[model samples]
Target: MALKNVIGIDHAVVMVKDLDKAAENYKRLGFTVSPRGTHSAHMGSGNYTIMFDPDYMELLGVLQPTEHNAPARAYLEKNGEGIERIAFTAVDSAEGAEEIRARGYPPVGPTDFERPVTMPDGTVSAAKFRTFQWPTAEAPGGVRIFACQHKTRETVWIPELMKHANGAKRLKQVLMVAPAPATEAAHLAKMIDRETRNEADGAVVVPSGGDRADFVFLTKDQLGKRYPGVSLAGLPERGGAGLVIVADVVAAEKALGAAGVKSAGGVVVPPADGNGTMLAFVKG
Candidate 1:
């Protein structure tokens, strides 16, 4: 069964060794990051968020060495900081997991988790979710995938957190590098129940969430064409590579310059401050 354009991005996760420093770097890049928070003991992870309208970017790091944080910590130690995974916004995680399983993709869990959220005005609430994770171990040369179902939307997103110094509005695309782009694309297409198209440049484009965002797979060379400034020195063979964010690149550059954050092409945030993930700014 052909799936509709149902998979939309909830947020992109950047796995860093230190969450505080990572959030500071993103703020220097002109994003307005949220207050740092940790998950319940069972989930044992911490995060700082850059919330955009309907979408966000999470700077995730491990906390205590409980069952939840251990695996995340292990991945961070091995990957050495970079885009960890892209969480797709789903209406229902259980239903979504069923779709993933039917399509032959291994579904890790349709697990429920919640985090405490303190509003900009000091109000507290529980931001809850149900997630279906597709582990990275399964897709060695590909990026991690998961579906997120939000339970308390109001607690997570509010007007105060949406404004950023860079005028960034939305996540446009996620770039993944693979040795065999076509083969990986075919498998990924099935996982999301979406049609994956083979591109002229040996890439595949998969539209997610009403086509609001795109999951694009390409070789390192092809990705370089899209982001000329980013160096592929220590990039993972099959992993999350670059994040394409929609913003006023020129204005964003000004803000970044004032903060002394130098971007390669006035649009690409270099690896150092980007926490191993290439940040690409594009005009919306």
Candidate 2:
């Protein structure tokens, strides 16, 4: 079977302990909120707000749990609240899920959804999506890709809160840091059959479409030295807790400085150790 056509980034999920506080932080940075909704009712324990931009960002936090339904709670217990998944848009949702499953990756179904979004034209547009999940217990790069097809292409809504004034054209790359870079990179490479390069910082970049996703392995020793106070002892070995969003380097740096957001040589870094937020604008 042919590989699924990756359209682009569908959305990036950030897991937080308190959705309200997280939303406030993001709002301070400038992100317009989308409508609120629950995930696959079957998943049983979470709610989210979809923030629109040229690309989407999802703020996911667990809600009160029902007896016997505790995955979200378990996740919070383990990861201590951070980014859980990064979704990509595939060309054919069903085929894509199947292709991944056929290759030995745990692939979830093509779950469908119809949601209403307010368009820039002052009209409401209903959008549909077919989502799939890739289950990787020990690899860290991107977790899943959800492909979507809208009823009316004429009314597309990209959230204004996500747009940066620095001319950050698009999501150029995603950086994932883990513990076993080589092993995780190998598994990801085998799964996607893509070329990956080992970097000096024990990181690997797997090229996909026009964008590249980088996975970096951080050992306990490394974490201890770099982040003295943080604890990530028994967290899930896969998935990204942090993300590095890319933009146009020069313009982004200038824009960030003008906005009073501090930067480290043009790169914005968050304060967490194993998990955090970062943004960079390079040549692309």
Candidate 3:
């Protein structure tokens, strides 16, 4: 059978110099992050995950300079605390890799990897994943893209871990700024095996078929107009300039107030207050 198209982004990966500080910043923004997870010595990295059902956010950093830590360290140095990767979801990762190969964008894996995830009962279980990864070097704009198949979903998406104080329900869209929206978005769509359509005033919008999310691509000039306060510190490499999410406006307002965040007016956290990642919360 032909593999399924991109089901939507599985997760947005953020690289940080300090996982503790990163988690603390997210907490200040009213998010509930998971416990620290250590990668195998071969991988040489540690992470904190924010679970949102099947979709989650990953904050990764180097544990030490091992084989795996090199990549994370390099990304942190190059990007300086911003989005480093975007993973698309597929029912079968190997199949997803095959589809990418067919799409003219050759992929590296559907490689099997697992980390011991602590269960709600405090028992340890393997959180297995079949991942097809595309390194930033392969992408036109140096943004990492991949397909992920979750083999043990239950072990990762425990119900208790899904709740957040920010009242964030789900990720709605990702705001991206590229030099040329149409050209860059077309390339990305092909990688994801999704369709790209033009939006008003020289922008491209790619709607993920796998889930309720969209990728909005715009020029830096247009992005500035739409979100005045957002800083364009890191452009295409940062990848995720802004993240849109469904959230309770009232709760967001309270949280922003308590955090002394003046940028978020009920539902928006501009880059200034959002760890260089602009955040827009859809009032619901």
Candidate 4:
């Protein structure tokens, strides 16, 4: 049984050393990056959001060392910037935490935090959120998992931010490279109380709720096979490899080309060109 309040993928958190530079890179890739927002003092982190319809992407950087952000800091030091975690949309984080406990996964928090959002009219407002995280060991294939409750969706998902220059729309799938794709997919299914299906190309698919993006797990060799001729030099050995976006391939290609960031065969973007996260643009 899937956790009742847990809906689907909310976003992917990309850890970057230089937040401003990362945002610029994403903009060059045709994303409409949001203005910087600083999290609550206790969290000691800042971020820029790349909004999509319901789903999005976050570029996170540590502003200062705090107990609450120790793990994130450690991850950056060890991983050298990459997709560090994935978030699920939760109806109620407190209830979600209870469900997680019932399912035997010890959750970290139902903690609340807020970030200020500056409206187009130059007024400041706040976007609040409540979140809970699964234990580190429970993370499948080294990618952490968490649940988020958006208390102020209006403030966060502003209409203007939803449009991308590359015509990117919503997140379609998250790709992970695991030693044992089936095992990892099975584990993820169990954690979320969902089911897994197999793909023809030896990848395991773990579907998310509603219209949200699914998670795809496969081996590095399989990934290379799937995107023939695409470089995989900086991809992690056993973690998040990239993301697939529902977008206009032509527009995406044009944007990337204009920025001098070559996309392999006009679809696959290697990790090196994607700020440590590979990107695949597909027709919606």
Candidate 5:
């Protein structure tokens, strides 16, 4: 069974060297980027969120070296920039931590943090969150995973921020490239107390709860086959590759064309164009 209080995907954490630049690039790609928000001083990081209805994407960058942001810094130095972590929706972080501990994976923290969010109406409020993670070395397929409890959802998920010009509605899949796709998928499924489904093309899928995004594990060769002619140069060998978005493909193609960003076959945005992570848009 899935851990108590742990629901579906909440958001993806895309580590970037420059937060503002990443935000700008995503805006040019037709996303409605949220205003930059700085985290607690000790964390030494800030982020810009691309909001969807129940899930979102976060572009995170370190402002300075700090004990808490060491991993993020290391990742940025090593992998440059791309999807580094994914957060699951936690109904109650404290309880979720306990459940994770019981499942044999020691939890990291039920820590609290807050960031100031500027509302559409010029009002600013603190968006609080409680989060916990599995062990650092326990990342499945080299992608760190965590659980997040949104203490103030309204402040973060402002209505205006969810409307994107590309008609990007929600996450469909999070792609991870691994040497052994089945093994990695099974590892993640066990970690989340979920089941894995095999695909005909030899990929493996771990479905998150409800209509949330599924984690898709594929071999590097499979990834290449999936998006022919797209460059995967900066992508880590055994880590996150990209995101598949449920969107209006026609609208997305038009938006990219208008911005002068060419997509492979009018569907797949290459990593070079996506700030080190690939993006694929498909009809829901």
Candidate 6:
């Protein structure tokens, strides 16, 4: 009745030009990596791998060059290489997808898959996922939710791998940048039947309903200023697009430094000639 309560931050996807390279980058940052999988057979994209946490992170790369489905390619061409999609855990993938489609929005499918994941215990686990996409004019900045049903919930790798001595817990919030936060907020409110808060800086914070993942939408100016020279044309509309992973800003800054990943005033920008993947560790 109150719109399905959000579960939690499920996973964040980073679109990279090179999957192997990006995986290495995250591995150096302390994420326990998983075996690589090719989505080309199903999604028409390239190679991808999941970095585990209770919530998760995805590294997506364009493997084969083709003009058939150009959205992924266009994203890579325009943005260079950065965060591509953010997937939220939904209450019901089929029902959720149907609900959005019935709202006069573009259609999204109920897709599911089973993939192998390597746990820190050096064990292989087959994880199942069900996903849905919501179409909006905002594409990458749009609110897209993905509901994942793990074949086995007994072993969640996120809590173990992403744990920090500084008590970084789980992913609490994801900040998104968009051209029109107010309109986007209204659309999402109608789609999900939830209330959204409009901030003074023209950003919107959609609470994750207690323990679920919270989504924050910021303006282009805010994102540009934060990242300096990153482009935002290729992000998906109305789905999990642009994201800023929430953390203790000071601690995260120090961690990034230790990982040898340069930050532009505490922001990470994707390669200049690559797609724009921007992330900032802001104090919650």
RMSD of each: 2.5, 5.1, 2.6, 1.6, 1.6, 4.8
Model 2 TM: 0.71
Model 3 Cα displacement at 29 (Å)?
1.1
lDDT of 1: 0.77
Q: Which stretches of model 5 miss by more than 4 angstroms?
A: 258-266
Worst 10 residues of 4 by lDDT: 257-266
lDDT of 2 by residue, 140-169 (tens): 543433345433433335545345455444
Candidate 4 lDDT over 9-76, as tens digits, reads: 99999988999999999988889999999999999999999999979999999988899888888878
Off by over 4 Å in 4: 258-266
Question: What is the alpha-carbon RMSD of candidate 4 to the true structure?
Answer: 1.6
Show the lowest summed lDDT stretch of 10 residues, model 3: 258-267
| TM-score of structure candidate 4 | 0.96
Model 6 scores a C-alpha lDDT of: 0.55
For model 3, what is the alpha-carbon lDDT of residue 29?
86
lDDT (C-alpha) at residue 273 in model 2: 22
Residue lDDT tens for model 6, 1-284: 34452354677666777778876666554344555765434565544443334565667776676553356667567655665555666767776666666666554556776655566678876656666666624353533444454545554454454554222334655666666767766665565556888777567877655465667777766655555654545543333344444555556545555432344444342433223444444445
The 10-residue segment of model 6 with minimum total lDDT is: 267-276
At residue 108, candidate 2 shows an lDDT of 60
TM-score of each: 0.90, 0.71, 0.89, 0.96, 0.96, 0.72
Q: After the best TM-score superposition of candidate 6, give how far the Cα of residue 175 lies from its true spot, in angstroms.
A: 2.7
